[model samples]
Target: MEGMVVSTDAYASQVGLDVLQDGGNAVDAAIATGFALAVVNPEAGNLGGGGFMIVRNDEGGVFALDHREKAPLAATRDMFLDEEGNVTEASTVGHLSAGVPGTVAGLWEAYRRFGSLTWSRLLQPAIDLAAGFEVRERQVATLVAAQNGIRQFESG
Candidate 1:
C-alpha cells in the first residue's frame, strides 16, 4: 500500500485505495487495511471484535467468512458478580469483559486466502508498532485523568 500508511483513523480506507491503485485485489486490500487498523487503533478495533466479510474474484466467484467468536466456556451471568453479588465495573474492564477473541483467526483466514503478501510481512507492522508506538496526546491525557478510577490496571 503506497502512501497508505496512515493513522489509526484512516489506515483501512487508505489501504484499500492503495491496493486498487497498485493492481491488487479488493479483499487483499481490505484484509491488510483492516488488520492495520486493529493494530493502530487497538482501543477501537480490538482482537475481541467480530465481523463478517464478503468476497468476489475477477471471475465473479463469491465467498463469505463469518469471524465471530463464541461465548467462553467459563462464562456465567454471575462470573462478573462481586462478593455482594453486584456487577463490579472491574469485571467489565479487564479479562472478564473480554469475550472469545476470534479477530486473529479472522485476519489469518483472510490473509491466507486472499493475501498476495506473506503473513510475516503483515505482522511486521504490528511488531514494529509495539516496539516504538508513541502514545497519542488524547490517550495520555485520558489515562492521566482516569488514573484514580483505573488505578488497578496501573498497579503492579
Candidate 2:
C-alpha cells in the first residue's frame, strides 16, 4: 500500500516516510513521526506533553489511545491558590504546573498493539536527528518568537 506522512515539520514528516519505506505500517510511521517531532519541533511536540492518537486498521477496526497528562494524585482543587486564597499563576507556569508525562507510555502502548517495526528501528531516526541536524530558518524564527514566553519561566 502507498502511504504518505504529513507533519508540521519537514524533518518529522521525512522520518515517517522513511519508516514506511522501510516496511513499517502507518502506526510505525506515526510513532517515528512523533519522536522526530519531539526532536525537531520542540516548541509544539515534546515528551513532557501528552496527546491522543486514533488508528483504523485495514479490517476497519478502530483503536483510540488517550495519553493526556493527568494531575498528580496529591493535587487538590485549590492547589494553585495562594495563601490569600487568590488564584495564582502556579498552575499556569513552572514545574508546579506540569502533570505526569504520558507521551512515552502512550507511544509504547501504541507500538505494543499496532507497530510492526522494531522499537529500536523506529527510534533511530529521531536519535540521529537529535544528535545533530541543521536547524531550519523557520525553526529559528519560531524559537525567536517563543523566547519571551519561555523566558517568563524560572527554568527557562
Per-prediction TM-score, please? 0.65, 0.90
Clashes of 2: 0
Runs in model 2 with CA error above 4 Å?
82-86, 149-156
Candidate 1, residue 69: the lDDT equals 71
| Model 1 clashing residue pairs (backbone) | none
lDDT of each: 0.67, 0.92
Q: Which stretches of candidate 1 lie over 4 Å from their true place?
A: 1-8, 11-23, 77-91, 141-149, 154-156
Residue-by-residue lDDT tens digits, candidate 1, 9-98 = 554456556555666566566666666667666666667787688877668889888887766898887877779998887565776676
